[model samples]
Every structure is written in C-alpha cells, then in structure tokens.
Target: MSEILTITTDEVVPDREAVFEHQGIPAGRAVAAEIEALCTAAMEVFRQAAAPAGVLAEISKADFATLYKGDGQNEDATPVDEIYPRAKHLALFAVTVGEEVSRRIADGFKSKDFVDACMLDSVASASAERAVEIVQQRFLERATARSPAATKGEHRRLAGVPTGETPVPQFSSRAEKILDISSTGGDRRSPVDGVLAYSPGYCGWDISGQRKLFEFLKPETVGISLGESCLMQPLKSVSGVFIIGPKAIHLFDNCYSFCGRCTTHNCRDRIRALDAGG
Candidate 1:
C-alpha cells in the first residue's frame, strides 16, 4: 500500500551551488553580479511557487514480477536484475516541484526572457532532484530504525498529507525516537547500508515500464500525471524505485547496449557517492 509522504517548499529548496551547476554556471568561477542577482530572484520565485509533494509505497518482489523479467519482446540484462533480487527492502516513489514552476518557466520563454526562464528552469530541476534526495534520506532513516524482526506488513509513517485511501499510520514511540535521533545526524548503523533510485528509461529498464510503475504508485494523488510517452507532467517530476540493501547489490559494469552511446554514465557517480557515504 502507498502513503503520502510529507514535503514542503522549504525542505525541497535547491542550494545555490546546485542551481548554478544545473544552469551550467561553472563552480567557483567569477559570475557576473547581474547573473547572481537573477539567481537570487529566481530562487525566490521558485520558493514561492513550488509545491513539493510525494507518495511512497513499500513493495516486495512479487509486486513487479513482469518488470523483473521482460515479456518476450527483448531479453537484455539490466542492472535491476542484479539490484532488486538482492534488495533488503524496496519502495516505489514519485515527487514533483509542482506545475506553477513549470508555468512560470513557460511564461519566461513566452516573454522572451530566456535568462530568467533558464535560471528558474535550473532551479526547478534541482528542486525536483533535491526532493527525491530528501525522500531517499528519510527512507534510509526509517529502514535503519526498523527492527530486524518487524513484520513485512508493518505500517510506517512519513508525516504530512496522507495520500492514499488508507488512514495515515501512527508512529511507534521507539520508531519515532529513532527517527528523531537519525534526522539530527545521530551515529546509528543501519542493517541496510544504502539506497538508490532507478527509473524506467535508464539502465535498460524500458521507459514503457512507467505504465506498471504508475499503476502501482498512482502519483496523480499528488498532481503528477503520466502522459502517452511515459513522460510525467509538471515537467519537474521524478518517479522511480528505491533499491535498499548493501552497497554491493547496486554495483554493475556499464556493458548494456545503451551504454556505448551514453555520455554521462551518471550511475557510476551515484554508486560511488553511495559507497563514500557508507
């Protein structure tokens, strides 16, 4: 079952460095005063307009049987084949920075204010990503706090608006205390070491897989919608599976057919960062 994850604009605001990086402004370079001023203004607009929200559903292996293996159309081995089978826990999630930012970006373009539009676009993108990171971090804390003997059907809560039909799950005192300590940077070691999100359209997971992902997640409760091409509306939205387990499960060499033409190889950086944090 899925529950609404609490999110707020303040929590999802992108840092200046991330916003500048997304806008292709090199780090530590001498930026023009005007550019700096624009970034400040853009951030204000984003903070005012952005409505960050998300939904999370803890799932098991049987939840995605078809996605685990293809339907006979293609037989390419994907990273998830290595990751999911070994995951100690898994969840599907989606988050968005709201449509107002998208509308403002379009308005900027329509008004031929490319500079303002570009900065806001970068901020929105960064905010979307940051929201995901926040959700992932919270999930990490929850996973770490949970007792080893906790039942699979055990209910969990992430405060704020409860999304699905079910009532919000109450927090156990021990779990709540653990959450408080961990959120403040306590020194608790988690049974599960790491978590990384994998969306369709990457790592050989077909983009069309969004169909099933949406079926399970139903993120529209948070105002995100999937279109014909599996692209999410709000333009600044992200959806994917959270793979939780030891760092080893997430490791994979870039050897798929899609890898040769790929330029970024971002998965490498993500895995390395996870390892470093561990």
Candidate 2:
C-alpha cells in the first residue's frame, strides 16, 4: 500500500490572511482559517486520487509561484504582460507519481491492465482522470457558493483600470516580445475549443457584455487553443479565437462573471468619464 502524503498550503505559501488582503478582500482570521481548511480538503481529494498511482508529491508553493510569476527566471515563467497583476495570489495544486504508475495512469483508459492496476480504488474503482474530475467539480461548486465580505463593487474598484492622469496601459509594447516566444499571437484563447469570439457586449447592451469581456481578458492572455484542456481536465478547458479583452484577469480564478458597469457604481462612473472625454 502506498503511503498518503498530505501537504498543506502552509507548507508552501504564507498564511491565507496575506493572500486575502493582497486581493483587497476583508481579512478575518476565522474566515482565513476556514478558507485554509477548504483548500486542504480539496487537496485531500487529489491525494486520494494518487493513492493507486503511488505516493504523490505536490510542487512547492515557492516553485509554483515562480512558474506563474510574470518575470521569474524560470524558462516557462509567465510573461509580465500575461501576468494578471491584480491576481497576485495563486493557489495551485499538482500531483506527481512514479514513472511506471504515471504511464499506467496516462494509458489506463485504453489498457484495461493499467486501469485495473493503477486506478484509484479507494472510492470505487476509478481512473485517475475521473478521480481528478470529481475533485475539480466539488472544488468549483464550493468556491462558487462561498460568499465573501467584499462586494462586487469593492472588487472592481480595487482591480479597476486607471483613468485619472495617465491610465497605466494594461498591454505594453512588450506584449509583442512575449508573443514571439509564445505559440499563438498573444490572442486570448477560450477555455473551450472552436468557440471563438464570445462577448457579453455582443449579446446585450448591458454590463453582462462588459463582464464577459473582462473575464476573457483577465488571465495572462495566452494564445487561444482549440479544445485545449486546462491543467485540470473537465473542470477547465480552452477553445478557439482567444481575444483577451480587459476583464479576463479577474474572472480567471473568481469565475464571477457579472458586469462591472451594472453593479459597480465606481465602474459606471469611470465609464461615464471616458465617454465624456471621448
């Protein structure tokens, strides 16, 4: 039997209080504790999935941060232009197993021997893929249901694009430099394949359109791919016509897709200012 190795975010990143404050969310020690528990529980599921594959080891938070950092020294360091400055806190979880088990897990669905041998048996016999899917679904549902003290209005102001004096340009000329190294032309790729060009703006005249655009652009606008699955499969996928509009950064993790113009008074005021200026 493989030993279960469970590691908490505390082992990798600093406490959750700092992360929450960095995002401009109200800080509560109690709430932060609850959030940490939730993260641990979510990681537990991944640990269980790795049981049959062998002992699982997760990447350290410091390493993960460097991987996603915009200007880190890592070869795959996320580009500065692609980095969502507003999203300084990233909670990432990954699993690593032995080479033999890794091959079995990868080919499990196709080969019955591998499936029966390396599949996670703790919760009914399940392939690694299915086990991962179940965990992701549960995680997302819980995250979506949780209510924070910060209102949508508050979040927008904190993450809002500057308009006074000289608005800091979100996309710098270095975007081209970043794109030269990336696969796509720095286009915002959809999580779902072939479904290019979705704008809440095109669908309606309301803030929903603006919100959709924002979510699409918030991530470090990587190139779009057709039917590309995210690190977490079934939970996240990428698709066609990647257009990184202004709002994709916030939506990347929060999954809160609501129009800033509709809900955020400050955002509405900013839009009016721009309109008047135009």
Candidate 3:
C-alpha cells in the first residue's frame, strides 16, 4: 500500500534568475526588463496550476535478500548479502506535481508563451524539489520517533542520492550528513537525525536496475510509472529508496550538494553559497 502526502505549491514566488536559467537566456541579455515581466506572470500560472503530490511504500527487511539477488545485482556476494548489509525497513518514494504542469508547458509553447513554458518548466523542477523534501522530512520524523529510536541504528547505504555537487567514491547523502574521511572505514555510524534518498541510477543502477525498485514499489498505487526506458512518465517526478539509520551514513571528502551546480537563487531551499549549503 502507498501512503500519500501533501506539499506546498502556492505562489511559485518567481525567481527571475531561475526563469532565465530555464529559458537559456544569455548572460549578456539578463538585464532585459521585458523578460523579467514575462517570468513574473509565469510564476502566477504555477501558483494557480500546479498541484504537488507525495507517496511512499514500506518494504520490510524480510525480502531484502531475495529482492537484490533476483534483480541481477549479483557480482561477488549473493548480491543481496553484499548490497544490503544491515538495518531494517525500506521506503520507496515517488513525488510529482501531476500532468497539469506538463499540460501548461505544452499550452505555453503552442500559444507562443515562452515565459509560460519556461516558468512552468521552472515550476516542474521546483515542485519536484519541495515535494521530496517534505516527504523526506516526514520519513525522518517517523523513523526517529519509533521505539528503539532510528538514530541508534548504524546506517548501511545500499542506495540513495549523491551527497553533493561533486561525486563521492561511496555512499551518498546530504552533504551535512556526510562525514569526514577520517570517519571512513567499516560500518560507519552516525545519529539517525535525518532521512537520506537513493535511487538505482545514483549508485550505478541504470534503467535496468529500476526493475527491482518498481517491482517492489508497485508505484501504480500512487499513479507513478516507469516508462519503457525506465524514466518516470510525468518527466517532473522524483523517485528513490530511503531509510533512517546511523549506518546509512556514507563518508566522503569535502561533501558538497548537487545544488552547487545551480547559480539560481529561485528555490526556497537554494543554497546561496557554494560552501556547505545545507
């Protein structure tokens, strides 16, 4: 079964910079007032048109062994025993702003509404960003409040998001949650203070790897689908495997966020500085 959740999509609060970035506006033409006005109007469309949604599924530890092995994850160990070393429980997630965002994008292009298309593009990206954060926040709260306290479990990163803008050699999580190299070693542990996301594609699992994720997720319950190529259909959707446990933490040098690549200040959570934008 899937657990559905809500997230804010009110007033996109247009970030002119993000709009320009999305529009591929040249740096030389950035100061154009005409473009700015267009972006502002697009933001209004997002507020009125976008509807963000979040859904999650609970996978017990019992199926871990069979799941990884059958997925052809086998390399050295029996696959399952190799990838999923420890801990309990798994949460599969998918978040989207629905087809309305795309419909708006199509309508914009058809009517010569460049700003509408571009800003709606920004909204699609922005909605996916916020929806996932809300879902992760909710997951962490639940994982931490349980009887044993989620923080106590040593984290074992089987899969999740890249820790930062720069790629690390190992397990990925939010940069702040990532530890220094000195802490790197066997079974690294940290307080289960937050939830981290991972997908098949992140840790080298490609479209083929997603089969296990979808089979286990049964995303249809939440209106998500893996296309013939394994990409999410809505195009604006986000999917990942997440869990809360100390061992889930991965070590790295100077952990950075993927947001480091973005120069836009449009996102509410946009890390203004390149340094530790947690």
Tell me, by lDDT, which candidate is best: 1
Candidate 1 wrong stretches, greater than 4 Å = 68-75, 147-192
Instruction: Candidate 2: list runs displaced more than 4 Å.
Output: 1-72, 75-85, 96-133, 141-150, 154-278
CA displacement after TM-score superposition, residue 129 of candidate 3 (Å): 1.5
RMSD of 1: 11.3
Better of 1 and 3 by lDDT: 1
Best by TM-score: 1
Instruction: Give per-residue CA lDDT, model 2, range 1-278, as digits (tens).
Output: 11233332223232334334433456664555554554444334334443222121122335333333323322322122232343322222222222233333345545664323322221121233233233233333343345222332333333342322221244222221211112234453222100012111221222222222223332222211112212212212111111111222322211123332234333323222221221
* lDDT accuracy of residue 226 in candidate 2: 17
- Candidate 1, residue 102: Cα displacement in angstroms equals 0.9
What is residue 5's positional error in candidate 3, in angstroms?
2.2
RMSD to the hidden true structure, all candidates: 11.3, 19.6, 8.5
Clashing pairs in 1: none
Report the C-alpha lDDT of model 3 over 204-263, residue by residue, as the tens digit. Answer: 334455667778767665566788877886777788766544432322222223334435
